[model samples]
Target chain A: GDTSSAPASDAATSSVPPGHAGDHNSVKYYKGIVPAKDLKVWREEGTGNGKLAHYKPATKVDYYKIGTTPTPAQIAGWTIAVPPSGENLPAGSGTAAKGEAIYSTNCAMCHGGFGEGKNNYPQLVGGIGSLGTPSPEKTVGSYWPYATTVWDYINRAMPFYAPHTLKPDEVYSLTAYILNMNGITKSSWVADAKSVPLVKMPNRNSFNWKDPRPVTHNSACMKNCVSPSSIKITSNAATMNLTPRLTGPVDHMKNGK
Target chain B: GATMIAASARAASPAPTAPPADNSWSNSLGAPVDARPYGQPSKYESSVVRRYIPWLSPTRLADASFTPLQDQPGIITSNGLFFERYHSGVPTVDPKEFRLMVSGRVKKPLLLTLDQIMRYPSVSRIHFIECPANGATEWPAAQLNSLQLTHGMIGCAEWTGVLLKTILDEAGIHPDSRWVLPTGSDGAHMDRSLPMVKCLDDCILAWGQNGEALRPEQGYPLRLVVPGWQGNVNVKWLRQLQVGREPWITREETSEYSELLGDGKSLGFTWVMDAKSVITFPCPEKPLTQGPGFYEIRGLAWSGRGKVKYVDVSLDGGVNFQRAKLDNPILDKCMTRFTLPYWWDGKPALIQSRVTDDTGYVQPTIVQKHKFWGHDPVYENNSIQTWQILASGEVNNVQLS
Candidate 1:
């Protein structure tokens, strides 16, 4: 029944293939065919074979190997990303007093004066034990795992209307202000790249990189496993029907009648 | 002036007096602010706003916005009025720093800048960009009220860009390559893998919308415009393109946009949107008020696969149908307007429109569509929309029993 592959005739082979290529004949075919060259003679010579056959010994293949390396200043301008572990922290300092001024002028309208947040704009502080509860409202103090994430997020996109408008010192000050409000930093202390990364967040140990438990079953259910009864039953009839009976309410029954 | 007199004299003679009146917008305004560097929609047409149904999607900041389908008259929808859908929100990317990298199965890996993309031979096309879940209504319960529900999240714009086939050809795609993965530069870094055949067929790296540079929301520097396909595939803020033998199965394809069937199986890549049409005027919000004279019933019809061939309007619901006249220049994968003149008797009537595409696919009924897709994620829900006008001139969305 499956006899689709039949040998093409000489006429068909000389013409063109099917589908998109065949529609445009000029695109489908080559003018002439060349015979394969014998490789035995080439292999006998020391000039051909091994890596030397494809490439020369003195030739440089890579761009960096040809002495066309990028300058350090160029790399520093683009690759300024600092990690959460304080691995590539730069020398800078900012005080909580300066941070409060920056937050009030730039962020107060959307994020509230005290970073309490209005409407659905997100609360920046509080909600200390809300995680893993009925309705979790994750804030800087309660849910964020790393202080560096706070710094990175503020530096990258913040102030709502105009993102990346703040200076480096302003971003540092704002980070200190938000951290101080969350009770993570002292009111009088200033925050730097060195100090900010070491200040352990309250929920730093709350999260895990990977979940061990399976979110859903992987294998296909066949044979006995495919039965309706084989499906996981979470509750029974007795538990489903158990309700508090209204025995003492005669007035309610008379109204229904 | 001489042509106007000759046309009027010929019309008076009544020798098969020109093909019926076009009844389009008269005294059409020319392109104002022509000398300005950028262009925008007319000042008089500023009331159109992208709406949101509060009950369906609760959050204001996080939820989707609907295009004002009822308010828009012409075939084109300006770039600003286009609907927006975001996951982790729109990322503010600096155009100067933006770079598009093409890697993976290619002879030459290219890192092209925005300036280089603009230098390529660009082609402009007037096409419709629609979200797969455009008409997501709670059918069988209560039909939605406005045209915003019937046909929102869809817009037509003149997109100017380089054909994606040109870029792939330049890169010299390997023989083993089958899929092209496009990654976004948003905070979520959203990505999707599409068949290489679709890319080669017709895809664009658009930079201009409505004859001007793209808006920030519509991907200012560059965005993939996959015409007639779902909106998500037109990845905004495009950053990377990776050629691979197999699909990447990103979060968008696997978790979010995939549709779940009745049997608990999922349809992963339902790309092409079927034929769909919607009656814009005399809908629930507009109502029928002009008494008994000749009034024009106009609306838009389009297909994802090809150009719309015919649109039939039924006054008495689906009982009787009449062919509506289609406007000129019915472009492929673009919105086409259809109109019919009708005289009302100041009585109750149920109105509906059906679209037929060049691919010979007809718009299915609500019941028929429900039977096939079984609606969980509500993507590609294209069905015949009905508007019922009461004797008292009260209009509402209704379904025939």
Candidate 2:
């Protein structure tokens, strides 16, 4: 039923096969997609193999004719991302000593005073050697490979509720404060565009770049796949009663009610 | 009555042409067509809607909702009932002042307005977008009882837009460009670094979904669609695309998304979601109403790698299995609906489904997943799902050791 991969030689298969929904034609719903009468004409175009009937591949055209060249002023306003190499890292400097006050006033409610995490929010510090243990605590100090990401994240989406409100100096101070709390840096260490990108974290080399996927090769074993004696019921969600009940479609006067 | 019948049957037999006693709908005039300028679903289908848990996130703005997969009949999810995931809620952008900027590592930096973007050659394709953390809650055990809660983070729809290749070609990419950083216009300014090959392959700057303008939650005026990748990388409320030489280790990619291995070293950039499937009909929410009779067991199977080649349904745990029939329009990287004819025998049974993608990769079991990646990695939980069917015809979520 893959129209794009269908052989061109199978031109005889021009009509919609039985048991096939009309929407399967890729046009979907002749009511508004295509007029009811034009449906027959669409199928006659030899595109009835399930590909989008209206699609046409791109062709040659004049370049730089439609959109205008973006001015430097406009580009400066929108460019906000800081890459790994810290190429576009912003200017300004701050120290953990200066950021201690900022952390309590802005970030400590959800992120915690010692950066150990509060409630359900993510913990920003510690968990350096917990990755190999059974209970891995993946935090900024333990997991993240680069420290510039700390500054970037703080600058872009910190304070949770009021993001993009922190100034560049405040972001640098917060990054330094988090680093100091994680024991990666001292409270007196200054952080800036030049200094933040150069700071080496413990987990700098703790990443696998190559992706060797299709890790599990499972066969469709049909009969006696596992010993019946080895089968065990690990958990049952019905007994927990954690699922929320709401009245809506498919109520059936049961648990959904 | 017999005398009246005899009087009516003058030439032959009398005709029974009277209307049914209770034709309530047709007994009165119907509502006018313009009653609802923009129509909504019938009130009877109120329960077939998207839902979210209150405790899923810290705030309501940064939350996720699950689509009622059990109620969705086919591969395509209706626009209104589609799953919703937001980082900073939805922002209403004025189309008159919107512009998509293309800069960094490009020969010509261009700023295209909505009208200019719509003028390009457009192609509409059907694809499935799935959150990598779909089954994260159930990793430790079966915590969610409903299919909507377990597998509701995914939705498939027909998307219409111009290919990123078209836009890149217009701007003329630099020879040294290898990675692209796409940033959003939301409060968090969600950004992700992607390889150039994926961008040039099937990425689309989409503005339309399922035949009309995209909903505000799904990114109204414009969004980015990286086919067959994690939903996070498909930046919504797209604002800019910056071509660069190296990957930008952003917060979303580093502090999150990456998989932490058992050995302490994590696997970064694990984007493609492997083959996964779930039995939607006989799940916790949708139980077998009729007792011990012929029924159709239906489910959904898909892969980020490619089309689903086969889906096998097991009615008795993992002891035995039967090949399920794959429905039509199994397009590449799209959701495939599968069904199996089943007859319940009034006995306790364990129902499950397994999928094999076009790349000959079978859906792994939870045990097998833990063997390689360990149980700590929270993302990418695409393992075989088991549902216990009781003798009373109730289905419950369960885990097998």
Candidate 3:
């Protein structure tokens, strides 16, 4: 009898949330369950109170996961990253003889034909024990922790301006060549991710993790801090009450005092 | 014999001419044994170095490198001399093989080659590229000498590039696209997301720096030039641009650039650099001469949001301020040179400059800045720089309070 009664039909149709199971209203009941009309909106909104709604496709989805799994060859095309442990070793080998040729053409201009660095270009060989010294310059034999890192870096970025220009085989050969020059591997040895990681660096045990704790700082023993026996005051001027100045001798200062 | 004697007398007699200063070449001249196709800085300029105070960060190269702001006079820093800071080492990229792929949330996923990018309508702008951490030292000590803290990391160059809006349009961005992520082709593969608005506003894909091709270290073939933003966001050795509906919380955005606040909540993805200025001359390294008349106090002022509206110089530190004249061609989101003609009587003087941006954001004092941001210093320390000039014409870095 009232105007509200006339709009009840319209309210029933408009109650369902957009892009939800309730929008497809052909079925009388879903999986032996009938949801109340009022609960349609709640179910559609995913805010239903203990009531299960019909399954609906998600509005947003990751399309990358929807595709079929790529083949090893296809995956390898994009994933050129070689890990420190040599996990993704390709089915190829490269000898130092082949590597020498690649090095001369690609790397020798900047790194020198013999791996001696020129200017800003880094040296690739020697300095096996220079890690802990006052001047620590990193090279293949000296500072690199893993040989696989060299392979990875070369494969990803190298030759200064032209990065990722080398093939996987070429990268392997270059790695072999550099390692052979550094005396880590023999000239005949082929370098892959596996063989590269196994190559031991001379300074592999040189580095120690620095921890700053328990107060590394110390003050003079005569002051508020403990002085070790290593600290010796050689000057007797202080005990004699004669301050030894830089310009004048202690005798003149003592006589003046 | 009489004529020779007359000539000798003329030579021995001091001519009424100004004697030439020693014309001997400086020992710093001549190329090293190995000649470089590209010239490097003079060996004597070794004092002008990129330094990292270890206390800043233990291992991060993104820590800081002061630009030899004192050693340079003109606005431009040679491509090689431009300060570099990287989360990872500089990735050597080959230009010939480089390819830029644009995908995600687009009608046409385009893989544009470097040559294709060069074919686009190009525009050149003289903009200053500055790292967000350019003046990081000012955060700890605001009254520190200006050049070392401020000038070193900022370099002006004529960047030639295509508008990013053109590239986005060419890629056919979908209606759902809200953010664009530019990724570097480096070992770390550093990535950062930009709001669609900023990308469409004034982003550039630069290929040329200064007058020539971009240097290898400065992203030779191509780089994203996000003007007025942090330098890192202007991804070097750029390889990919992915348009998406949401921001990618990459390593650079999450682990590194995010500033940890006093409340422990980090201010994440702070892209825009605030208004900042620094006094270049009469800094710590370059002391003023003993006597002074009309000394031209010069420095740089820039803003990420917009043009530098005004720069104010204060001789008594931050007490009294005078309007410094801005050099011409003050383009939007670019460095503007500000100069103050002042009379330095060689007495002790504390000099500082405050820049006001078009957005009405004034460069705050270090104390004021600390109050708002707290002591959580990572980068983007854009505060007023101060220098103390001693009576003996020695300039030293000093704290205000």
Candidate 4:
């Protein structure tokens, strides 16, 4: 299966082989949760004919204009986000003491330290009258109503195992030390994007943007509909069984109880 | 319960006169055509897997599971127990060094590959995806008690590829574009923003699945369905789309899936995915100890803003309810499967189902989504679930108060 369409017009960096130069190939390549590299192998190099030569184009192309445009500095190195009127934001400006030393060596294990979130990670700071309470604790300064979602989520997902490797002022000093531990600004405040959406979050007037859905317009009731003595009970996730087990087609990462 | 099997109307009454006298695989001679060359699924359906709740990912590059959806039935979703949710793990791409590209506000920026995106013109469809934190640990109450951990992230399949406005109509698009983003070469470069009229509507760019070739944890040769959005914008290993005009949001639309309300604003690209329903045989991993008598309750209803028109059920939780039937083709944002049949009488009831999709939305209770997503709905969490049963018959996963 080595069809050679012959168009070899010289140098492609020579010294080929190594299984067509794809590094070490152990079927690696998956980019998602990233870690596997190695598979390489797409060698076209210096015509030393070690096979793989199917370059027979020019028989009149344009299969929807074939491909190869990518430029603007390769789309500005993947244009990372940070909008919310601070447009693209990526410039710099940090404070709250450089986000407490970039939140202790890249976000303490997983969002801890001043952000107060570490098991199941997500605390970002006090719950400010816990949103209509029932155990609410949203954080990011009492539930993020936007501070450009804290410098676009710490420069697109902060060092949670290295995502976008934070920089724009270390994502504006961890969004000014997580909005100064959620007191919503201070600790000498100073993030960017127009004072990070002008702070003032505190449940930002309890969001609404539509979708209220038929929360309880109750209809389709083929019978009684809400009177069996007003059906009381209210909670119980299966007497604490905690589900988890599901294993059979092959243990999907065990651990249960 | 899940893995309950046999119920095409209860196998159309097939118990007439079964032979019970010395049946040895019905008297021997079986194993033939490539005996076990590659087919298996009947060793008692072996519990149907897809679990992995390792405290829902904190590392190893995020990944989460759960989708045995009560062992599954009618509405497809068996690409090895579907429901995945990876944020970094699962990449091995290599479709001859895949590519995709597309580029922002395009007037002409193509970069296709994966055999020019399987040579464009394809279509299939069936939809579903979900996981706007499918029940984000039931935001504030009755948490995970199976319906594959309360509404297994969700799956549904079929999906075939190419229709992102047929690759943005050969990359022409540029009338002040209006969001597109997509991204996703994995490694948390997940990306989001969608809106170019949902990639010119009906999204897709898929690469098969349910008809095969997509597995690599469901984004093999490429991925990006977006049908009904939020399954983290369906950007599996799909690589790039860009087409801007603003709206990158990212960080999974601003710190994961975004929804939070109860004031403190969050919503962001809400997308569709509203109307929802679920019964999944007697919850808590299929309980009810075989139901005091006749059965058939079944469940599963969906809606990313389409089909599912009706589905009620409620064995008394919402007071009485009834109209359940629904099954067959229902299509649209897929997954329909409903039933009813009744006759338990063993007492202590309280089930629930409630849907209402064709845009009318419905499907809400859990104290009206705890009074409008108070305690900020970590993610979608469709609501109305309930369960109960018990008079020794078992069941549980309750809430309705």
Q: Judging by DockQ against the true structure, name the best candidate.
A: 2
The Cα error of candidate 3 at residue B182, in Å, is 0.8
DockQ of 1: 0.02
Stretches > 4 Å off in candidate 1: A1-257, B1-46, B58-61
True contacts kept of 3: 0.01
Give the per-residue lDDT digits (tens) of candidate 3, residues A1-257: 11001121322343331112110122222111122431242122221121222212222232222212333343335444333334444656687899999899888987888998864466888765544443444566555544655776676557555666778789889988888888777787876633554555453332221111111111111121212333222221113322222111112232343
Candidate with the larger TM-score of 2 and 3 = 2
- What lDDT tens digits, residue by residue, belong to model 1 across residues A124-230? 88876654453445576665545655665676456655554567788789888888888777777666755565566665443322112111121111123223333
TM-score of each: 0.58, 0.86, 0.59, 0.34
Instruction: Report the lDDT tens digits of candidate 4 across residue range A1-257.
Output: 11111122211222331112110111121111111211011111111122213322222223455667777665656655444334445555888887888688878767777667787776677877765555667666665555665676666556756677766878888877777766667687677644554454554445443344445454565676667887787678766656555555544344654
Tens-place lDDT digits, model 1, residues B1-401: 99989888778864444653432343466446756666655666555566655444423444566677777787988677787776556667788888776665555555677887777667899888887767665333334555765578888888999887667766656544556777677654556767676776678999999967877777767889888888888888887776654444344553346554443334556677777898887766566776665667888999988999989887776656778899987998999999988787888787878888887777865655666556443677777777777786666666544
| TM-score of structure candidate 1 | 0.58
Clashing pairs in 3: A161-B93, A161-B94, A162-B94, A163-B93, A163-B94, B67-B152
* DockQ-best of 2 and 3: 2
Instruction: Note the Cα lDDT for every prediction shown.
Output: 0.62, 0.78, 0.61, 0.67
Q: Which pairs of residues have clashing backbones in candidate 1?
A: none
**Best-matching candidate per lDDT:** 2
Q: State the displacement of the C-alpha of residue A106, model 2, in Å, after optimal TM-score superposition.
A: 2.0
Candidate 4 accuracy as lDDT: 0.67
DockQ of each: 0.02, 0.24, 0.02, 0.16
Tens digits of per-residue lDDT, candidate 2, A1-257, equal 21011132322232432112110113231122122333343233222222323333243323638988888877766777765445565668899987989999999998899998887787888888787898888888887777778888888887778888898899889998898888888777888765675566677666664455878678988888988788788989887666777445422223441
Model 2 chain A worst lDDT window (10 residues): A17-26
User: Which rank order by TM-score, best down to worst?
Assistant: 2, 3, 1, 4
Top model number, TM-score: 2
